[model samples]
Target: MTKTDRPDGEDSGHTGPELFEHANEEYDAGNYHRALELFDQAVKKGISNEVMYNNRGAALDAIGRGHEAVDSYLKSVSIAGRYELAWHNMANSLFSQEMYADAVGAYAKAAALNKERVENLSGLARAYLKVGKTGRAVAVIRKLDRFTDKDAAVLLMQCDLYIDAEELVLAEQCARKYLEKNPDDVEGFAHLGNVEHEMGVYGKAVDSYEKALQLTPDDKELWNNLGYTCFLAGFFDKAIGCFDKAILLDPLYKHAWYNKGYAYHGADMLERAVECYDHAVAIDHNDPVLWNNLGNALYNLGRYRDSIPKYVEALIVDPDYDIAWNNIGNALEKMDEYAEAIPYHDRSLEISPDFDYALFAKGVCKAETGDLEEGYNLVLESLDLNPSYDEAWGARAVLAERMGRLDEALLAVEESLAVNSEFDEGWTKRGEILLTMGNMEAAEASFQMALTCLESSHADTAGGLASVVRRGEVLIRLGRFEDALVNIETVVLAGRTNSRMILKDLELRRFMAKYELPKALVEIIRKIAEPGIIAECAEFMVDAGNVLEAERLLSVVRGIPTQSSKLTKAQARIMLAKGETDSALMLLNTSDGRSSDADLLVINAGAHEAGGDFSKAADLYSSALGMDPSNYAAAMGLARLMIRSKKADECISAADIAIGIDSREWEPHKLKAEAYELLNAPGMARFELAQAHSLLAGTGLRPEDIIGG
Candidate 1:
């Protein structure tokens, strides 16, 4: 008869009965993978009536499916509660899973079923040791010592207890004792590795992992440990190889993927890092921090558009994410879409009100979008948030200077240098303003300070290009145009040249200030060079008496192209020159009194006086105060008109305001002469007019050319 069709008597010696024996043979041959499959088949047919689940569980444990093996052992014991062997197998699985409490219970049950089993007593002791029940574990180990010869486990547990109890010397001694008897034991090797790794002895940890791997070549946990130890010891490539092997052996290992990603990042292979993070996310997508890390990797790789959307996606899952909002703002700013960026920064501030970076970003974007006052206020808030944020303060100094608050700009720049003494941009800007104030020696000092600041900063090609170009302009302002050309040509050789608006500003007293063609071509070239440089160049032109160039430059800047405050101000400049004051003011169309186009306002007052409207001319000067509260031009214009109308007190007040704006301007001092003359203050009038004559010497006016000359 066939073995399958044999009766119970025949089956006693049948092939089906031999199935378990064959499974055991496969297991003994070190084919635990194949043995597990055979064991399952034998149990399905109820062939042996032995504790098949316990043997199957042991095979599964060998294959690294420790939790499943534990379930199999429990099932075997359920079918036969007195199965002492099944209980022992269950305890082994629990111990592997680190479920010390449950493992101790299983060991206790096994010992109850077979009171003489020393292995059961040993298992219970190990479980208790893992649970920090060290005294209970030692008591059980002492009972096992009476019968068993396996001192390896007992000595290992004793070492662990010593380490846990802060008895480091004793732990080392016990580890030595265990290793003396079992030099080849993998667990003993792992325990010793842990001790060294925790003590920062990375070299020793690596040696232990290597020795353990040699004894158990297929041990993936050991491989992963060796990789981690090597990584901590700064051997990244070697660690990567170890993690690669661990990942191959266990395809679902999440930690191996994460560690590999970190190693790749350290090597500056950012793209590979992002690729590894993608794998980790696929394995487990719910990790918010992983998503943030992935976004940072993408950003560092210059995939800004890709990175920003991920940050937004992370924010969707976690709305109060300040860092995500900060990154989103950065990407938006890089895109030069500041109008869109400001809201994200505002939201970040809402969540973390003292978030200094968000405050700075919000202000800078506001300034970029043309709300200078609002932007300046936001910058002040940033300073309040972090008083030592030198970059923000330096940027604020630039804003203050642009807004015509020169004294405040100087103070802000000083504060900035106090925070970061080597802020090159701050020193450069402060020097330019000092030069404009005719504080030539102070300006030279500031320019020298810039040299020091630049020396301490990172001077890459871009920074060097910027530095040389700016130094060229500074030299030009100091009437050192020959020296300026050297710096300008350095920029030219780098394929970055033609800065017209900047040249117009630096060429104030030069004969070419009135020239139009050179300025127009330069503006066009800068507009074409980079879109982000366009607004600054345009703003510079608007303030340089070349508003026409500003209008021309904006037409090429794209998106809000062909239109801006600069364009309107340029047209207004023309109308003011033509004695068309009302039309010029109407062209501005400012919604609030916040227009700081001071040159435009000065032009308005000129047009008003030319059109025979002195009263309206005085009001136009008042409007100029909003553009520049300290504008000497606005103050002098109103004072001169008031003197012509023979309004003595009114002329005096207007002159006071003008001198307060800039005591150095001749017109305000001369108007004060007229006021003093009409008031019969002859000595004061002559002294005031003398000061005016001195300031206006080379500015194209003879002494008698003044109204009261």
Candidate 2:
């Protein structure tokens, strides 16, 4: 919008020409108001020329009268349609007024008149960018680059334009060229850093940002950028230090606080991360990311109920925030409210159908609610969308296992571990599957691997305590009593209420007594006063041959003034262990008169068998099987009774049912061998015995132990 030169040799006979010349002088002296007054007077006196109007427009523009300046430039262009200066001035004026579309037309007209002018091309490129014509803007800048003689400003502008267009390689080229010409320019280094960051060359990004900081050490933005780059590069501690420096430079910098939270969260310092997020939200409550991050920190802390409000706050700020919706569902799912959590995930998927996390979450909820097939398909769909989603793979494995597709479950879990070798849950699931398949050595190795992963995670929270409990179960299974006790002690010391039930486990109690743990630790376990846990502890004591202690626990359970099938079962089991068959049957019959529970039926069948009522025992076992075909105890019990009665066909049928329930159990195969021997099928007997021996290989059981039983 610079003023054009005044027309030479003005009309000396007219006062208007003299006034126009004086206005140009005033404008040259930087007196825009006075120049505009004289120009208006000259225009009133009939001085209508392109140069006069263009110069007057510049004077108006200099005084912040953009609309008036545009009108003056239009007048100049209308008087002489070929005036490039007037067109360029009007384009600049229109750009200042945010009329980008109109500015593009004017700038294009100016460029058409003077193809060699850098100002016209630059203005046109900027207008194109403003109008979202990024490709056109790029083309214009490339043309401008040919004759700009490698201008530093033009190079920097081109770098920024390329970055806006997401042409990172070209952006990097322009930034590097700018730095080549302006070696110490902070902006040049910053642009290079941005380009490297977008390209995921984190090391180079860090170096460039560091150089920019050296040039402008007081720039908080440079420090923040360096911190985020380090965060993306997995340098959490270094990222935190950079964020600290940024906060020191500007105490109220919200992004610094937010970024510091992310660094802490990445490092698993969840409480500190929550503190930083609190500060961030206090500074800017409208920012959904801050609220969402606060929710995530709390969720990771096992404060699922507390996290819901934070996620709700994020939703309040941005109802369309799909991540927040999914997070809310995850929190509810953690609370075991799977049915309630499904609609939240559904809403998230509605908003963003390709949100794989939401799809997987909904799948988990469906599986928990007994829709195994539907859950499996949903998880498969999520895996199809994100092939590397390890959690989804793990969920699919669980569903496959539940559906009795054990081999498919094994392969799916292996796939999960393949994607993330350190996935502890995947290792844990692999161990459970292998144990079910009777591969004791491989199962132990898998559990050991799972423990290794959990130990390396360094997560000393509720989830960590749960992992410790899982490790304790593995240790107990592997007969590592000392290690199991150590894990139990860790959980007990953590004082998590959920550990109370785990402490009452039969094997865990045996380890506690065998290791002679302190009475204080014993007293900690005894503090569990819930009726259900007390009853379960009683049953555990009965199984451990501590009938007197079992009776004591049952008394406590019975005093709760509530009807409990568990209480009845525990009392009846204690009676049966004492050889009081009549008392056990009377208690079971009275307490579960009309109940059809398969486990209760199995217990009743055992009581009848102990009393030598083979007829009632066989009928009860058959009824239990009819109620639940997967009841291994009932199936084995029926098979043993059939063998005693010399009913080889019934024994083989019952043995087959037991085998169908769990192919890994050697007892069924051993019973089938005896059935075959009774029928004089020596070859079939040998084959069944071989299967039993194979299953019993590492179980410290000889062929006599299986055959004699």
Candidate closest to the true structure, highest TM-score: 2
Q: What's the C-alpha lDDT at position 23 in model 1?
A: 72
Candidate 2: tens digits of C-alpha lDDT, residues 1-709:
3354543333434478767877888888998988888887788788899998999999999999999899889999999999999999999999999999999999999999998888898889889989999889989888767764646777877777777777789889989988888899999999999999999999999999999999999999999999999999988778988999999999889999999998888766778888999989988999998899999888877777889999999999999999999999998998789999999999999999999999999999998998878889989989999989898889989899989999999999999999999987788788778766766668768877877776742226444555565566556545565776676566665555353434433344442355344556546546667777677767777766778877876676564676777788788889988988677767777773334477778887887887799999999999999999889989999998999899999999999999999887767777888999999998787667545544432232111111000
Give the range of the ten consecutive residues with the poorest summed lDDT in model 2: 700-709
Q: TM-scores for all candidates?
A: 0.42, 0.62
Candidate 1 per-residue lDDT, tens place, 23-117, comes to: 77777778898777677666655664436778888899999999999888887888888999989888988988999999999999999999887
Clashes of 1: 1
Model 1 has an lDDT value of 0.69
Off by over 4 Å in 2: 1-156, 164-166, 176-185, 201-204, 214-218, 405-411, 421-424, 427-492, 500-520, 523-531, 534-709
Minimal lDDT window, size 10, model 1: 700-709
Q: Candidate 2 clashing pairs?
A: none
